[model samples]
Target: MARITIIETGHVPRKYRERHGSFPDMFARMVRAADPQSTFDIVSIPDGDALPDPRQVQAILITGAAAGVYDGLDWIAPLEEFVRTAHANRTPMVGVCFGHQLIAQALGGTVRKSDKGWGIGRHVYQVTPNNGVVAGEQLAVACSHQDQVIEAPGDARTILSSDFTPHAGLLYANGTTLSVQPHPEFDADFAHVCCELREGSAPDAVVATAKASLAEPLDSAKLGAAITRFLTRR
Candidate 1:
């Protein structure tokens, strides 16, 4: 079985963690979908220095974080360096929300807090026609983020989008790397909890109504197959 080293850079802060749970639930599901047999050692480097080297790993999955990529954090520069080197060396890399932003920032692109409302719940992401990453497939994915990639990291191509999120997903021209802004790992219950903690209401009538239209459960199997396709190459 192949091993995946997941570097989790996102958390809701300790004061908030008791209410939110200690993990990003959605990424776990996607990893499950990727390969149930695949085991993972999660390295949560909130401080960033504790971050591990990906060179020894089979794959690197950067989990979503609540932090903005542009914040003057101590670890941003080093992590950005790690990503560029990983890509350059042909190590397969996958970025989620904050992870997506970091990758973009490192590769001559940018990330900014969207003036738009924080997208929560399952959002439908439209796959561009014949995108090799999406393979011409669309997914009703889950998301909870306020910042996004405004442009592709240098030498990257857009593969999926929605009217709300332009950089919903991207693939490096190297074809070995890809990322999804909307989470494939979110189950309804966990996603609802995230909404509850972040927005103070998940089952709220208005919120539920919004999520009703957006939150379609994507099969874990489908996402796993897609991840497998992504990692098998670079």
Candidate 2:
């Protein structure tokens, strides 16, 4: 069985957690659904949890955070360092949302809060040519992010993109790293709750649109399988 270490960067709000479990919990469920033989070890860095040895970990998966990559928090820098170390070790690493941005920034890419405002809803991404990271040519996913990787790392190539987030997914040239701006672990119900949670913080219209878009078809499970493949495959 492959062992996967999930670096928990942050948590869901108390209210949201009560209804939909924590972020790590969500990821655990999704990964299990994709690959039942896989085992997971979650390390919560925000709670001051120490990172486990990368040598013992078969793969490293980074979870999304409520904080932005440019927030300059003490833990942020260390997390980036850890990301670099994992890359150097050639440990298969998968990043989601903030994780995606952090991986890019750590590997000489650029990430910044977009003037494009928040991308919150079921967004569609057109898979870049000949990049087999994603299963489909076009995929719709759950997204909630204001920050984006404006410039990809020197060795990373774009794998998935959309009009709102042109650099939605990235794959390092070494083929050991993958990252995406959307949350494949987020099911439709969770996405709906997130949309509702943003009622006051986001524009009313945006919130409503997000909530409505959840009714549309989502390819989260397919993406989950692809993620499982990336981590488990040699």
Candidate 3:
């Protein structure tokens, strides 16, 4: 069993709080499915309190957030430093959405507010011509973000992409670091909540797709595959 630490990027404000399962909930579910005996811990590191010692955590999964990676938030920089250091140390890492952007930015990539507006709703992402991170023909995922990575970092390879976002996913160092633009952690009710969170109008088919996912959490299986790939990498 490996110990994994998740750095939470969602700020729980008064507007969204209660018994409602939070973003960490989805991330947690994924990790558990991936590695049943894995140890997981949730910490609100918005302040970027020196990242956990890598020796203690075999892999780190950074969750998605409402804010962009280039928002100039105080915590983003330190977190970026931690990301780079972890990568250098061979600690398996998986970043989601903003996490994906930060990994690119930390490694000399570019992140900017997209003029095309928010990529909200259920969109399709195409796997790279040949890559293992996405490991599928195509994936229909939930997307919600205003910023996009225009270019991949010096050491990263674009694995998955879509017209709306060119660098939808990046696979680094054969498999050590993987970042995804979409939110695979979202289920049906959570998807609907997120849709409402983004004020997105849920149509019939979209709702149905989302509902099906909620009933059967394949996101965890996908995440489990990622964990196995990352930890067992050569």
Lowest summed-lDDT stretch of 10 residues in model 1?
197-206
The number of the candidate with the highest lDDT is: 2
lDDT of 2 by residue, 207-233 (tens): 889888988999998888888888988
Clashing pairs in 3: 34-224
- RMSD values for the candidates in order, in angstroms, are 3.3, 1.2, 3.8
* Candidate 3 all-Cα RMSD: 3.8
Report how far residue 76 has shifted in candidate 2, in Å.
1.1
| Backbone clashes in model 2, listed as residue pairs | none
Residue-wise C-alpha lDDT for candidate 1, range 178-232, written one tens digit per residue: 8778766555665665566655533365466546644555543465467656764
TM-score of 1: 0.85
**lDDT by residue (tens digit), candidate 3, 54-170:** 556778888888787888888888889888888888788888888899988998899998776667666677777667554666677777677899989877888778998999888
lDDT of each: 0.72, 0.89, 0.73
- lDDT score, residue 54, model 1? 58
Deviating ranges (above 4 Å) for candidate 2 = none
Q: What is the Cα-based lDDT of residue 87 in candidate 2?
A: 91
The positional error of residue 54 in candidate 3, measured at the CA in angstroms, is: 3.4
